[model samples]
Target: MVVFFFVVGLEVRQEFAHGALRDSSRARLAAIAGVAGVAVPALVYVLVVGASGGEGLRGWGAVVGTDTAFMLGALAIVGPRLSGQLRVFLLTLTVVDDFLAVSIIGVFYSDEIRPVPLLVALGCLVALWLVGRSRQWSAAPYVGIVIVLWLATLSSGIHASLTGMIAGLLIPAYPTQRHKVVAARQLFRDFWQSPSASSARAVGRGLSKGVSVNERLHEYLRLPTALLVVPIFALANAGVDLGGGVVADSLGSPVTWGLIAGLVLGKLLGIGIATLLAVRMGAGRLPEGVGMGSVFGGAALSGIGFTVSLLVISLAFDSSSDLGRQATLGVLVAMVLATVLGWSIFKVAARRWGEETADLPMTLDSPVDPEVDHIRGPEDARLTLVEFVDFECEYCAHATGSWEDLHGRFGDDLRYVVRHLPHHPHGPLAARAAEAAAKQGMFWPWLDFVFTRQHALEREDLIGYAAELGLDVEAFIEDLDSDEVAARVQRDIASAEASGAKMTPTFFVDGCRMVGSYDARPLTEMLESSRRGGRTQAAKA
Candidate 1:
């Protein structure tokens, strides 16, 4: 159970770091919707079970959260085009709302409080927080503090799983570091030449340091936790017996019906209305590709309050007690109904609004120019991929490795374009340097060189690198500092902002912006889906 929650924590941490939550505008919209999602569910739970008195109201927190794993898995199955924005909203809401639900319930419902252990746990949390803020290289400190924190929390009256989640949250998340990749590969080369124990250990150490610890643990534990721990936990908790007429008794109980109403109907109303209200009131705009119909469909699916609901049930009532059993039945029923409701809403949305799953603002602000932009593959290709990048950005560097294969998949049918987005302090210099290389007809080669050697970006280094690229050094220097080159970089920056690109390596597949994972599989899927859509439109014409 602790392991499952830890994985959940890692997921939320990643989202905040590099995923959709990083965009404040996008996140704020989801956050506003999330607030209403929580409130309305509780309000519904109270209304349905209020007749049962104060004890029943305590179960309100149980309805406020949903199962993240189930919610996302179901979303993948839905597979609607241009629905990445919906993914972001649900992810932000679930992660934030779950934490609030658990923390609040833990505070309000625990039987006995242990201040000493809690204070010790608090100290560890503060330490972990500090470590996350620093540019720490090793995972040793994180692992050590988290273990101690877990033990202290176990002894405390507070739920220990909450500590696991907090520890995961406190760990920093970042995209792959290019320098570290190079260093790790070099270490492996050293080991290959001398296969001794010392060198082997060095290789292991290097590999661990190649990526941020937050990502390392998440990748390592995701499989086992998902396949084993979460499933086993679910089976253990969710497997209920009704052979002894317990179902008959539960049907008569307000707790059972209250949970159902709160999860299914309440979630749909709360999320859908809240998002609409927020957008209408000018608090935030919905993502472009997303529609209200899709939002409602997504909201309906948010009612699968599995793990947290079970945890809350235990916290609020004795597991063997009648109210607890009744609450359990309600949760199970809501899961079934939510799935049905989601499917129904999505179907209706598809028919009425031409919206299948979700939304995102994806149209490229500037059209591709074969003569002006650096391109790989045919300009008249059916698929267009545009990347907004800064040469100094490591994430952009990391992404270059995938482009060759991506272009290979579509051959002349896809054109890959790279545009400048000077999103960093050193980005402008790198862009100007690349523009200088363009003057020597070596723009593409210069990009490959500067990305690997981003650490050396001074004027002297740029000139030196330009010479290595077989360019006129003086001409390169002249162009590097030219007002014309600066203007070219500035133009790209303006286009990137106008296109709503908030980070380097933002991708547009067929003019629709792709968010979240930019790996080959997801990128390929988006490209293919868009290609098919384009063909269908053309055929209809």
Candidate 2:
């Protein structure tokens, strides 16, 4: 729990400081998607169990989560042929999803507790905060403190593992000024040097700095709480003894069926329906080189329930050994089904679609043409505004809001574009989902949806949103498998880098770079200046 919570804190900090949570809309969508995923699944589980007069209905909460490492690892094995955008999309989706899952456990799964232990826990939290703020102690002391907190939470009826997250949040990932200075110097040197030499130097320096800064910070920030701790918990708690009497009981349990059905069926239905509605309403469009087959293939893949679901199961039936096992079974079944179904769909689509034509000769190293107006003012009012953003990048999402506000204020004056810059291993799939939304002309709507629910962006929830958007379910699935869109997304990422866009929400104001979110006052000022310049040129002509 201590490790996990620390990771969570780190991830959260990263999100706020550098990741997708910075984009208000992205964050909001994640939160919403997370909630929808969790709520719908839990509801389904409860309804099924309740209708069947099953006593294990309470275990419905356990069947949530995306199992980031497993899912991403599988996708990774598929190689860059899969859309990088999709990977980022999945990451943001799951982060929000995990956040929501943990919140649910904290709120709904906690036991009747005494105030004394709770106060002690609070004290521990304060101490952890002090450690983070002060950067006084080495990694060992923080680790020890986290263990103590984990015990307290466990004894207090709160999940003990949650302490891992708490402790993680408290510990500093980049605890000292020296670390930051060194990192900055290294980054500067790398920028001026060859990639190979820079990378080698970075590796050596990073190690010698000691303290496992990223890992400790991840633990301090509770990112590991979600990624590592949650996964471990899932594996431990989810491995139900199938021979137990609970297996028989689960056969008749509505919660079990509901969780299974929700994850396997409902996710597809919700995402599919929402996608269709979005397309029909003309809010988004399919990726330029994608079709219905890909959508469905991706949606099916979205059902792989691992981490959050297991956590929910643990929480909902913390005491009911029988019910917990049943929930675990349901999760296991759903996960397998989702994975197989999704993979099968992807394979078939890839076969049918064959390889996408790489006719657009573009790569990350391409230069931006000054004459092209790629950002702001739609060529046609109905044109979309496509963006390639990084989730672990605050600036990317922050820029997203500016575009969104512009669209809202201008109405038909603009549309949206989307791409992905995972920046780190954990951000790709969520970004893909956003781009995938483009396939059905519901990209903006879906983006809005997920951003509003940023806090809940879970893996299952992302799939659920895809289904809810009712994209050409099959095409959406295929798109996830299709390398064409991913390549396009990659091209954009490269373009952004070439253009020197280093933050979230980097804007191309009619193809010229516009950095950061600006209020109307500054925006108008710049606009007027540009207008004046245009007039002066015309007059001279």
User: What tens-digit string does per-residue lDDT give for candidate 1 at 306-393?
Assistant: 9878878887886567778889899999998998888788888899988854653455777887767888777788888888887777
What residue runs in model 1 are displaced by over 4 Å at the alpha carbon?
A: 78-82, 130-136, 357-389, 395-418, 426-541
Measured by TM-score, the strongest candidate is 1
Error of 2 at 436 (Å): 41
lDDT of candidate 2 over 241-282, digit per residue (tens) = 767577787777666687788787665554444444544565
TM-score of each: 0.79, 0.54
Best by lDDT: 1
What's model 2's overall lDDT? 0.57
The residue pairs in collision within model 1 are: 289-359, 289-360, 290-359, 362-513
Candidate 2's C-alpha runs over 4 A off are 77-80, 134-141, 166-216, 219-252, 269-299, 318-322, 345-541
User: Going through the candidates in order, what is the number of backbone clashes in each?
Assistant: 4, 166
